[model samples]
Target: MTSMMAPNAAGLSDADIANLAAHIASFGGAAAAPAAEAPAAEAAAAPAAAAGDVAAGKAKFAACAACHGMNGEGQGMFPKVAGQSADVLADKLKKYRAGETVGPMSAMMAPNASGLSDADIADLSAYMASL
Candidate 1:
């Protein structure tokens, strides 16, 4: 974590990391079971389970199926969203909606996210994670 979290990147201090760690520990830490659920090729392709509703998220994901594939199996430049971290998904959506560029696809994603409210992003993130 120290090596990957460069200063000014995510704005986290050493204390902040410690606090986050404690928070995670409070919940018994991350489970190792999820990684084992998939095969070697997708061992690390797990998803995040945030405080969003999976059912609602599923309904909201329909519109995203066109480009993200029916099951969120992204192809080419469209990165896979299925089994992705909820935090990561929500973060990207929020960033895109705010007109912040996170990558080459920002131009296309930004407009798509512009009209999305926080609820929509959460629902979408939850839905994608479940995939």
Candidate 2:
């Protein structure tokens, strides 16, 4: 008797093939993973500075201008961040700093946000919101 196997079988178990098929199907042929959630503690942490300085935020934003534009109008695939709420921006930054994949750009943002403190997030958020 001959054992029937899948045509593309290359040491992968039937279950493994099924799982791979499911994953591929979920993305409609694209291989994107779902966004990760932020840790509860990190998500709950309040902004370090009570009031953010727009000047400081502007200074800090110099690094962000390359992709976001000097006026915060995002270029190409980059999303526009200007006019976002301070709280929302801070939360997203905190999530990025914690290495959570909040969006498609999380990989790029994680490195940039890693060095920011809560105070820095506040300042940056304030500046971005002002725009």
Candidate 3:
């Protein structure tokens, strides 16, 4: 953090005060892009998940192994999904698939959920829940 002269402090030159003020102004103002663009970018990058089947979910989960771990233990920023409730998991996936939740990873999972039927969602939910 850069400090400026306290209202009445020392011998600062005019340029020094101007530079500091500029720096301070720069800190709060938007650089170029509007803040609204960020959410749009995230939405575009992420995929939306949706309802799926439990039995079919197992097969679907197979494709998720690379990042979620073989047993859904998860790694790094990836969350552990093995013991998650089916209802919750299904809901989250549905959000991702619908683009309601945007993120690069969510976007990736969205397409995977595209063709899933209701039974597939239930099965996957049950399988993941049981795990």
Which one is best on lDDT?
Answer: 2
lDDT of each: 0.67, 0.71, 0.56
Comparison by lDDT, 2 against 3, better one: 2
The segments of candidate 3 whose C-alpha lies over 4 angstroms from its true place after superposition are 1-56, 102-104
> How do all the candidates rank in terms of lDDT, highest first?
2, 1, 3
Q: List the residue pairs that clash in candidate 2.
A: none
* Model 2 misplaced stretches (Cα beyond 4 Å): 1-50
For each candidate, what TM-score against the reference?
0.61, 0.63, 0.51
The parts of candidate 1 lying over 4 Å away from their true place are 1-49
Over the stretch 1-131, how does candidate 3's per-residue lDDT look in tens digits?
Answer: 11322322234468755754554353344322211223756644532223444566676676555446668888655668898877676656655545555555675566555544445556666778778
lDDT of 3: 0.56
Clashes of each: 0, 0, 24
Please give, for residues 5-34, the per-residue lDDT of candidate 1 as tens digits.
243225556775575555434434332221
Question: Per-residue lDDT tens digits of candidate 2, residues 43-63?
Answer: 567443347787888878866
Spell out the clash pairs found in candidate 1: none
After TM-score superposition, the amount by which residue 43's alpha carbon in candidate 2 deviates from its true location, in angstroms, is: 7.0
